[model samples]
Target: MWLYSEIRTLGDIPRHYSRITPAAPALIGADGPVSWSQLDIRSNQIANVVAAADVVPGARVALLGKNSTRYFEILFGVNKIGVALLPLNWRLALPELVAILQDASPDLFFADREYADVAEKAIASSGLRCRVIGYDSTRPGRSALDELMSAASSDDQVVDVNPWHTAILMYTSGTTGKPKGVQLSHQSYLYLRLCEHLEPSFSYTSEDVMLTVMPLFHAMGVGLSLQALYNGAAVAVYSMPDPGKLLALIQHDRPTLLPLIPTVIQMMLDHPDAATADLSSVRVVVYAGSPIGLSPLKRALQAMTCDFIQFYGATETCAGVTFLRPDQHRRGIKLESCGSPLPLVELKVADSDGNEVPDGQVGEFLLRSPSLTTGYHNQPDFTAHAFRDGWYHTGDAGYRDADGFFYIVDRVKDMIITGGENVYSTEVEQALQQISGVQLCAAIGLPDAKWGERVVAVVVPEPNAVLVAEQLIAQCRELIAGYKVPKEIVFVSSLPITASGKVMKSVLRDEIIAQTSR
Candidate 1:
């Protein structure tokens, strides 16, 4: 745990590892294993490149890519010069990406080869004059990141980066239909690791290998990967989540730590190779991002025969608030609970009036932690609304039992978490309204076996207007990300409305479920 105590900032992680365990494997990807020394040297070169470009402290740099060695290098390099790294979600559509770029206004942009075209288009549309740096593949107008790093100095670049400075600027779907950038500081990550060190449950060892399949844009992917690297463990990075390739990687790399969602868990278990795949190397399987059904939890436990830990939190909290330890994951033993607050976390369930609720009563979850984000970038109004009286107001509804175990019942904000992605119903409903044929529409999440919840649009067609489900779905696809698109469209004559003329999504969701079951 010397490394945990020594690292004061995110930039120090690579520097400490380079000296203590230079020859140890830090990352394992398709390009092969990269040692701690190599990682440190490469990150230094990256820092020198950005510094030479005259980017100053508190400036923003962006990376639009998947999970790769380049992503980590960019993350550390950007942090080295006291600049924040804004990781863009690759799955977002062009307009969505354009809006984010315009809002953030990063000084430089790094794009993976696969997203070169879209990245260029977003910059042009946003009218930003930032330089486009390419990785993996190069375009005619862009400079390759590898070539720049190769020619830059390997000497560590020192900048006055404080623990309060923003390290990562992550965007989450907003209720107002625009994404809000969550500003996470160096302490947001380092303090979480320190808390883990103090408590010592589900700890990582130097010999462990982490299988990282989640997207780098997410808090879970970045948080877990940094955790492994901080402990001198190796991370096996996959480009994306593919059940077949994941099964093969488990056999080859024999990763000791695995983190995933319920959807991926079911996919891997249903794969043809899962029955014969060797998953013995996995010591602990951690799941979060969304609620997992009791049935699927039991099925996964029976199939993998490894320790399972479920933690609950969001991007705003740096993703580690409560944890269901492996020892507590048994039948009739708080399986439905998301477990207790972490060592450094303070949690309370509050009602709408901001009053604390009694035990076993559902209310909004409010938490205070060192890992909590300072605020949303450039959105002071939003920050003021969510953070009050030294506590971050989580719009999630949950309850704590007499034994201190917390159970999440629902999301008070009406945010639909499908396949680990947060999809705001209001955002989808706004898109639906753009279509002429949609007179009235409400988006709600329904329980699904594959995805934790499937987005469903219950719509009332315009009078005498001809509309088809397939056509509406196609139109909706152009307005939002594919993941936010509703999987099914139900045409109803009328939608139940409240006295205030607001669509009652709860009643609609219940009705849809009853109709579907029939």
Candidate 2:
């Protein structure tokens, strides 16, 4: 067993685990299991190579890859030299990647073999002059990660690392506009681990085997993997999320914990293999990234014999601010709540004037925690606006009940103004989700000459199910106010979602506008 007092920096993790449980499995991937001692030595070698590359301290090292064990090695290795690790979203298009790379301007670019083409395009588009290294590739001109590791020494070296120093430069999803790089300090992550250690329900043990399908580029994946490593737990990583493959991994690995998004869980349950899959090893299942419908939640609870935990937060909050635990997953008002704040987190719903709002009144969610990001990198204006009055304005609109449970309404920017009345998109979407045929739906505001903006809904129906616009509107009208009802209903085969499972409302809104213009 390891004490929280032993962990001070990212460099301390491998050293502590290597000393205490040298033979324990620290990482288990498709290749094989890597023991703590091996991970420690390999990471040390990578760190030495990175430091000897003539790269200055506090420089950015960008990684473009899917989930892999090498990704973790590079992550911790960069941490040892006090350099920030910027995990680029490989799902992004060449143009988007170019824009982000230009903004980040990392000193080094590391790409997985599969993403070499995209990385090259991004580097070319941005005109960045940096060393390009390929992981698990024999491509000429580009250095190989394995060769670098083999040639470097495994002996650990001391580097000046400060808690307040930036450790990660995580770019936002950019659903609203250009992606902003969020600067997270080493202290922020350390504080997060402390919070997890203090909370028994969220804590991990060395005996636990955690199955992580979430993209390592996202905050949820990074935080979960780090927590498992810090606690000496073994991590089973899947490069990508596939329902059949995930079920197979669960049955084969017999992992104790699984963290996933609702969309992935829904797909897994819908798969034919789920019925017979041996999921008995799973004791806890953590889900977040978006609001899940009641039907799916209920079905998941009935099918899987495990604790269901709903985490609510954005990248800026380092994954979770509030947790909806299994015991609170009842069929009543609690179903609508995202649960209470986590330990060391302070939350309140504030009105436009920045004063705390009364219970049940919708307002912007504000939070204060040691785990919050330091600021947005290179965007002082945005950082100033987001971090104000000693609180991080989450930009998510929600309300607190008398019982202290927080219920999210919608994103402040996503709220619709119809006939001078405010309509929360989430309210309409929740009502739409209750309808039997609605598989997925996104509510947005379309520009209107009269109402300024009108409510519009794009829905995806369940397989073999047919939906009518009038019937859906009528169903929503019965549950919500008339103005909140979507004026326009467009049925599609699918909705645009980010890699992390969040609906890309900005993309949908643009498509609707284009159609209207046509």
Candidate 3:
């Protein structure tokens, strides 16, 4: 009974849901399901707690915690008072955390007790005077969140807020340098739901229970969860990234919706219980974070027995600019395509001069969507360069087919130039994935004496599967061009993966370079 028209901002989502389905399960955390009414009251309690900490409108509050119902409560509660919530990636190092803390200069900080020591170190290192509240327990004298919320009133905090006000201060993955905070307004997150409602291209129903396993700090995890909530769907929050536990949850909860990265999907399939696990309850599997290879896609399609949707987007665009719908997943028909732009999403492939390139030509992806981020926080110069003429330069290299399907070649920086020929690392990785024993693979450009850059591949083999470097190369040759083939393949047990499920290619490249130099 929650109508999209009634909800103006992120705060209104819980309030609207509580009115119609007070007893409906809003969130299922480790502690169990929290009803819509309870979530609304808890969010009000959190808002009061945030206000009492002297945090006001336009200020920021940073949270360092894993996935939980409390995260949503804090997010909505902070939004209720017009304060943006910056959810820090708990996987970050102390100095990294300190850097973000110093950059944001938040009004207050919240951390789970698990990260107490690191949070204290970061606060001390950054010399931030902001008060710290622990989700589990604060410092000796100060009251923790539970104590404060228990004492605070559950009355709604009414603060007039602009829909354009920043609700999330999400930092980039920081592969290149310091992580830049991308400011996403309430409208940036909400508009996509409206688009979905109008189009229904991968619509969420009230009966759907979205099981989110990705880290809450990432865009995909929080974004998908909010999208589900906006549609009156229950969200099951699983904090850890354990594939075994994730599979067990699927069997037990029978969640209808799954938004998972391909890496996690691979791990789940490789798990011992995957064969026997009951995954029939799942109606849709949405894969994102990175491009999934054909091998894993086939395996998932066979195993899950449900519709598979692939989303392609970036932090700049809060929602997916393009989606490969279930019907488009047919074998040997545009399998590599990420599908056309979503409704209300205008997309084009542009050359370096910013002119739109003809279809079927590789170029940078330029997109403009209603849910697009306004800009990077405190980085006007960087923002000016990226967002130009009403289009966001995505730095992704790809081309659209004649039929309107989009194919992502590679990240512009990730493209390898070998012997004066362009080689897409994603293409090479995709080819390598076709090999029988290959489990996970990352292709990178390494410094070469002859070629400007040589293609080097780091591969992880399946368990108990035997593989040969020569044999894999021979197999890859059949799948792709000879020039695109990797010059060398290094076998490993696992590749470095980010918390968001992306392979840390820069880190992997550096490690490979260091090992080769030695």
Question: What are the per-residue Cα lDDT tens digits for candidate 1 across 16-69?
Answer: 888889999888887688888988888898888888887888989989988887
Q: Write the per-residue lDDT of candidate 3 for residues 1-518, one digit (tens) a residue.
A: 22547788899999998999999999987677889999999899999999998899999999988787788989999999899999998766565678789999998888888887778888999988988888752232244888898999999978888889999999863334445899999988878876666665566877899998777887888899998998889999877557788888998778999988766788789899899988999989988776566776887888878888888887778757788888777444677788887788999999998999999999999998999998888889888988988899888899998999999886765766554344667777877877888899999988764454788889999999998888888777765557677888999888899899999988998999999999
Listed in order, each prediction's TM-score against the native is 0.97, 0.80, 0.80
Question: How does each model score on lDDT?
Answer: 0.88, 0.81, 0.83
Clash count, candidate 2:
0
How do these models rank on TM-score, best leading? 1, 3, 2
The model with the greatest lDDT is 1
Highest TM-score against the true fold, candidate:
1
Better of 1 and 2 by TM-score: 1
Residue 149 error, candidate 3, Å: 0.4
> So what's the TM-score on candidate 1?
0.97
Query: After TM-score superposition, what is the CA distance of residue 402 in candidate 2 from its true location, in Å?
Result: 0.8
Off by over 4 Å in 1: 2-5, 137-143, 330-332
Candidate 3, residue 507: the lDDT equals 91
- Residue-level lDDT tens digits of model 2 in 19-136: 9999998888877788889888888987888887876678999999888778778888888888899999776656557878999999888898998787887898899997888885
